[model samples]
Target chain A: MSTKELCIHLTELHAKSLLNDNDTFLFDCDGVLWNFPHIFTGAVELLNYLTEQGKRLFFVTNNSTTTQDDYAKRFNDIGYKAKPEQIICTAWLTAQHLKSINFKGKCYVLGMQSMKDELEREGFQICGGIGPDPVPSDSNAVTVDTLELEKDVDCVISAFDLHISYIKILKAATYLNRPNVLFIATNDDASHPQNDEIVKPGNYNAK
Target chain B: MSTKELCIHLTELHAKSLLNDNDTFLFDCDGVLWNFPHIFTGAVELLNYLTEQGKRLFFVTNNSTTTQDDYAKRFNDIGYKAKPEQIICTAWLTAQHLKSINFKGKCYVLGMQSMKDELEREGFQICGGIGPDPVPSDSNAVTVDTLELEKDVDCVISAFDLHISYIKILKAATYLNRPNVLFIATNDDASHPQNDEIVKPGNYNAK
Candidate 1:
């Protein structure tokens, strides 16, 4: 599908309801806020309107590769005043959600570094990944700490990765596919605008 | 199996393989290096040996959070001179591996900020997820991102999330089940050692 179709679908979201001051409005960053190659035509206007209305604008995206400051700067560079407190990207949301719900203190994340760090903040202990060594390859499954299944977990979050491979898939799917484990994502855009080209990597494998 | 059994199996890896001077020895930081509560029996020795032998000791781990520098400091605090350069964290590895494979530089990762930042360093364009939101009351189909099904994606990687509901699984599984899509994991440990307690929130969910 073209970006137009995706954008149209995304725009339809706004028609469903006008966000209230008390109710939070969640907006994905790329396709929704800033369309591929071009910022959303009405983005600044909408932000201005929201600010005037005193409504909470939450930029809850799934792209974990950036921090709120990054998004804020990008938005600012693109002519919008993106606030750190308002731009609740996936990493931010993931961290807040986990802490609010009290996710387990120790975690075995399978995501970008930010997501991992976010989890660690909620008192979760981080266990790193296995390296590319053991010759025969899949002779053995990588060993991880048995913390969640052994007890209870808050969730499992995944971020965007441009260079994901079969091994990453097998490892991530292995865990994300579990019934007891919680699964979370940053945003759900099929493609991201990169260097004037629409790049593909996130939606298919991790979504 | 039990923790001891798992440990025995990991130790058995030494016998199952040959030691190489060039083959880097990568180890996870949180659980494998130490018991989380006490100092690892030989962390200092191991680090010193790794540096002295000039063995490329790459710590390829799945913990998708903390940054390489943060990890280095943690390792250093524990008496190991771990540098961000010496670490092959999942976040960094994802980007490094993606560049090595000539990926599209677009990503759909299910991880944290560090994971995303690390991948972006390799010039990756991060994508968010898109789909219908969860039914609020349901736990099975929590959609994290709002991406479409037909978007072209190069790969998918997962890290740690403790809050994924059942609904989220349905969405990700639908995408990941496709053919030719790459999957990768930073680490596969089921959990991590938080404090005196053996906490949960590891990779068992996605296993």
Candidate 2:
């Protein structure tokens, strides 16, 4: 039988049992919970129903550009009263992973302000991720001396960024050349989805 | 059948398949990895064997008095090369939970310096957890006016502390009485273990 036909034949009791058996519900924020730029219809009602049933709700997503606070504010503005702790984004995960590993060195990053803010809040020393953009004239040549890099950097973190640059990539690559330097990416999405079109993501080539 | 008699013998192939089925292995640090001050016999050899087999390792524990960095240092000192990110203590989890929830208000904490450091590193505004001890003369009686509190606190975090005080408890309790306040505990461990002895742990009274 076709998959669609099988789904239509599922018993209501079995569906109810599936929901009743689980005390916690973990929803993927993007796509499943809501499409970007707007929340899906009945999503709010479904969340309310789960809460009324005393099921713990968690929003898990890979969108690393927004901090938990930013996500919480957006949720509230979009009519979902989500607490910050209930939202687990990749940005927070990256920070947690770094902290858990006891990384104590400076980091060269390729991402946006949200990723930077999350890492910084976790007491990570971050550079080359977000801030004033490097001018095209800043680089004299394609080749950069290894000595030119700020010393003692031991980590290179790559995340989604609209402002990713060759300079940022060069810095990240340079730091990653050291065997001791750790390299991390929030997710491995080579293309970003926007308004129903896919385009090469900025972090795609960031080492 | 007797409990021991009920055990079924497994073939070497089955044991090998079980080991080969997974790429990661998680070990509890305190009892399994190390018995307090010393590493257990064969623990190092077992870890070496796992690493040789290309298995990923993680150390999970509930000791919240130390940060990941501290734990890593101890691991290194004990001849096990461990990354800080491999350690997941309750202190780090507490901080991660608070940050994920986007808790922006001040926190009244009842924890040790490590917990305070971890939370403070996450940019939490914390007080009443670790600092100068409350003077006995400062309190005329057990009762304290609500106005005496540093207002606007919206979180009360409880973790293990070596210097827990009545003043800290009162302050944490007062902040917790607010309807909007968030209360969090690292774990439900009522007593702390040291050198094979369990003693009354800090955070025993904070609800």
Query: How does model 2 score on DockQ?
Result: 0.01
Per-model C-alpha lDDT, please?
0.57, 0.70
DockQ of each: 0.02, 0.01
lDDT of 2 by residue, A83-174 (tens): 98898998888999999999898888777678888999999998565642332332222232232466677888877755543345546655
Q: Candidate 1's residue-wise lDDT over A34-123, tens digit each?
A: 754467678878877776776667787767766677778887887767788877767667778777877664444445556555555556
Of candidate 1 chain B, the 10-residue stretch with the lowest lDDT total is B132-141
- Among these predictions, the greatest TM-score belongs to 2
**DockQ of candidate 1 relative to the true structure:** 0.02
All candidates' TM-scores?
A: 0.40, 0.45
* Alpha-carbon runs more than 4 Å astray in model 1: A1-207, B1-26, B45-57, B129-152, B177-180, B193-199, B204-207
CAPRI class assigned to model 2: incorrect
All models, RMSD in angstroms = 17.3, 26.9
Each model's interface RMSD (Å)?
Answer: 15.7, 27.0
TM-score of 1: 0.40
